[model samples]
Target: MRIAKVEAFWLRCPIPEAKQHRSDYGLLTAFDMTLVVITTESGLQGFGEAKAAVGSSGVCASIVSCVENELAPILIGQDARNINELWERMYNGVRDHYAIKRGRVFPILGNRGLTVSAMSGVDMALWDILGKSLNVPVVQLLGGAIRDRMEAYASGGWAGADAIGEQLLGYTAKGFKAIKMRVGVMDETVDYSIERVKAAREALGPDIKIMADAHGTFSVPEAKRFCRGVEDCNLYWMEEPISPDNKKGTAEVRAMTTIPIAAGESEFTRFNIRELIELSAVDVIQPDSAIMGGITESWRVAALAAAYQLELAPHCWGSALSFMAGVNIAFASPSAVVIEFSSGGNPMMYDLVEEQIQAVDGQILAPTDPGLGMTVNWDFVKEYKQ
Candidate 1:
């Protein structure tokens, strides 16, 4: 089927005051995303999400504009099933012929940032359309699932030392066996971040798997010190301890600490992930489908993780479309053992879709429904679209 139309809407849903939490990204007041819809000539439609930021809040106008003014024009009359060729066309711009002829990238100047983000949404929608056309789930299109279900970790913890344990236990009460907490600048000091993690470990005992995400706020030395202090806690992994800009510094911290380093949610494409792997900076690769180059690129990252013997835990902190996209990748990749479940007040994750995405006793079953396995809540989109 040929692509008939492409539309993008910027959706921003304000978080309820009681559900909000503070972190290195500051107190998140709203959740925002760019929703992309691709309709085929035969009346089939697919949905995808493009993110402006890794965190909960961002200005999505630019992403919407990029999809409408730039990417959509290139895609309107193309064959909807030509997903890979379309991706290269969007990336290579006018030089797509060269890339196709040479079997390598001849990317445009906008290869990395906003253009990639827009491409991510379009690529996801294309996958959704392909799966629908074949009457199969997205995971099946990715060579079927390796497991029936996958373990998930609660991905929100912002409480201070005094209340951190209780906050984490709340997630466990919901049957999550693993949990992640925020650290770094949010705590105001590296030592305080250490104390909070220690307290969480003490309260949860050794059975519960704990992870700490610094949101790329700490310096190299500070990350090293925090790792040193929490060495005894047996953290599942330490995530984004330093900025994404410093691959060497992240490698240095990883070398100094026994804690496995995890990163890549802030990155753009497989090329960025390739650098992280080459530098030996991370033990786990966490590609967010919405921010990185969508399912097409995330699957590539998962393959890299498998080849390199690294772990794959896709970052799933955005809308349900992105979260389900990550789940599909996780289920299909042998390297992916666990997926992320947001524990914060994320409206986009819950209210953006008609499906109820929840963990059952800390495990998520593989999706059997067609496409991304979610029905868009157009009413919700109408109310929230900015």
Candidate 2:
């Protein structure tokens, strides 16, 4: 079916004060995401989500404009099933013909950042459309699932040292066997971060897996020190210890510490992930489908992870659309053993779609519904559209 229309809306939902948590990105007050909808000529519609930032809160006006004013014109009237070709067209811009002819990228100047983010949304929607047309789930389109279900780790922990253990215990109470906690600048000191992790480990015991994320706030030395201090804790992985800009520094920290380094949620495309792999900087590659060129590119990243013997734990911290997109990738990729379940106060995660996402007994089942397996709650979208 041909694409008949493309539209984007910026949605913002405030977090209740009681559920809000502090992090290196500061206290998140609201959650924002760009919702993209693609309608086919035959009346079928698909949904996708794009992000302006890796965190929960971001101004989505630019993403919306990029999707509506910039990319939509290129997408309308194209064959909705030509997902990859459309992605190449969006990325290569006017030079799409040359890129297609040569079987290589002739990307435009806006190959990254907002342009890619916009492209991500459109790509996801196109995949959703393709899956629905075939009457199969997105994971099946990606070659079916590798397993019936995968483990899900709780992805929020921001309590201080005194309460960190209790906070982590709360996640375990929800049947999550693995949990991730925030570290780095949020703690104000490396020692405090170390103390908090140690406390969490002690409280959760050795059987439960624990992960720590610095949110790219720590320097190389600080990351090394924190790793050294928490070496005995058996962390599942240490995530984004240093900035995404410093691949060498991340590699250095990974080399110095036994803790497995995880990164890539802040990155754009498979190319960025290729660099991280080449540098040996990360043991786990976390590609957020919303930010990392959608399911098309994220599947590529998962393949790279599999070929390189690295782990795949897609960053699932946005709307239900992005989260399910990640889940589809995780199920399709053999490298992915665990998926992320946001344990924060994210309205977009729960209320943005009609479908409910839940991790049962710390495991997430493979989605059986066609497309991304979610229906947009238009009423919620109308109320939250900014």
lDDT for every model? 0.94, 0.94
Q: In candidate 1, where is summed lDDT lowest over 10 consecutive residues?
A: 21-30
The residue pairs that clash in candidate 1, if any, are: none
TM-score of each: 0.99, 0.99
* Candidate 1 Cα errors over 4 Å, as ranges: none
Scored against the true structure, residue 156 in model 2 reaches a CA lDDT of: 91
In angstroms, how far off is 216's CA in candidate 2? Answer: 0.5
TM-score of 1: 0.99
Root-mean-square deviation of every model = 0.7, 0.7
**Residues 350-374 of candidate 2: C-alpha lDDT, one tens digit per residue:** 9988888899999999989999989
